[model samples]
Target: MPIDPQAARLLAMLGAARPTDWPGVSAAARRDGFAALMRMAGTPPAVASVSDVRIAGAAGPLPARLYAPRDGTAPGLVYFHGGGLVAGDLDTHDALCRALAAGSDCRVLSVGYRLAPEHPFPAAAEDAVAAAGDALGRAAEFGLDPARVAVGGDSAGGTLATLAAGALRTRVALQLLLCPALDAAPDTESRRLFARGHLLDAAMMARDLADCAPGALDLADPRLSPLRDPDLAGRPPALIHTAEFDPLRDEGALYAERLAAAGVPVRHRCHPGMIHHFYGLTGLVPAARAALADIAAELGARLAMG
Candidate 1:
């Protein structure tokens, strides 16, 4: 399949303006790099209402953003923002979450989970689990239906979503993963195919793993990498989206296969001519909105089932 022309152009422009060794750079520098990249993309503002509220967690109060659909009701989503678990927060991904809420018509709870190099491995994963539990416990307070809830995210957020679903089990209605960073192990077809030209590079990914699992956790551990998870049998249905030119694409695809093998319902799509960050290009890339519509349809169907 041909890559989306718009995505190709965007990648070319990004490569032309490449920053020096982003992974090895300072944490602040990497964060700034992402901000600059998004600014360049000129993403649409989040149409969903935004709130900076706190939820109770075993650790303490956790910050989160609630994106209510205009027509509000059941089928709420708990979203984790992508940033390799080292950067990005509710604010950084506000626009994407807003678009998701408006586009999918599902209330979105953007979890502001703790990051790494400061918090590290199980920290972000733990925060995500606690936040999901907190949301479910207070579903009525958020005007959401307790029976219809989905968990999702991109990149590192994708890992959190998968972990959250597995950790919460029957509590979630479905799982949505976009170019998930399911495995940090450097051996995958996507890595070989799009290692350089794709918006996300292997070097930066390596850096993310360093920062995210700096503590006593193993990067190859299935608990951290859904691809390696021994059993995905009872997990909720899933809608997994991958990009042709993404390094993490194979991991997502493999996870989908694993889920299916475990009898978990799964729908996986590999968008051609698209890159790792294409999911967030809802404004710039037509394929992005198309993908979102597919996701919205899936969410609607899941809500109907519940």
Candidate 2:
């Protein structure tokens, strides 16, 4: 599929903000730049209430935000934000969470997990698993139904979600992933086809891995690349979305196929002509708003069936 015109324009606009020496840019600088771009999410859709909260992490208190559309106990989601495992925070994805919580009728707990080059691999993953467990154990305090809880995220956060749900399969009600980087290094056609032009280029991804895992970390380890897991049986039901022009597209598709083959209930979609992170660019890609709504509706419907 050809790139969406809106997405193309967005890429063009972003091209100006990209550092000329991307490979040489420090992780701190990269994170700051990414934060600046995410600010374009603009004013978020209002939820009934929003507030800062602290949650249990693998090692300590994890900073987080709570977005609730109701005053009483409700379905809940433990969410992580995407920034290549080194960037992003609760505020960067505030708008997206508001929409999900309001539209999906779920209380969303947006987690600010530990980042790379500081805490490194397994740290964020461990925090993800812990946050989900903590949310479930203390659901009442967050005004959530302990029985109806999902784990989800976009991009790198999606990666964390996978690890968390896998570690807590029987407990998590659902898994929501958007344009997730499923593998550290996958040799899929999409990886080659869209390697250069998309917002998340290969070089950027490589840098993310370098900083994310650093020394002695095996990229092929299922802990880092869940797709490599030989068995997908009993994993939580999943709603996986990928972008047509994303380097990570094929890996998501393959995972969906494998999960189904393993008897796991799952649904996957590749947004035609869309690029990575398209769902979060609704302000620019108007059509992407409908995609997000579809997610909200699906999320609500699936959990209701529980």
On TM-score, the candidate that comes out on top is 2
Candidate 2, residue 126: Cα displacement in angstroms equals 0.9
Cα lDDT for residue 83, candidate 2:
92
Error of 2 at 144 (Å): 1.3
Q: Residues 1-306, candidate 1: write the lDDT tens digits.
A: 788888888878878877657655877777777766654334654554666778655478888888876655657888888887877877777777777777677788888888878887778888888888899889988767888888999988999899889989899988989888888675887799877878888788778888877756776786577788888899999989888889888888889999999999999988777788776776688877677667666666776688
Model 2 per-residue lDDT tens digits across residues 48-94: 99999899999999999999988888898899999999899998899
lDDT of each: 0.80, 0.88
TM-score of each: 0.93, 0.97
Give residue 252's error in model 1 in angstroms. Answer: 0.9
RMSD of each: 1.9, 1.1
Q: After superposition, how far is residue 192 of candidate 2 from its true place, in Å?
A: 0.8
What lDDT score goes with residue 108 in model 1? 83
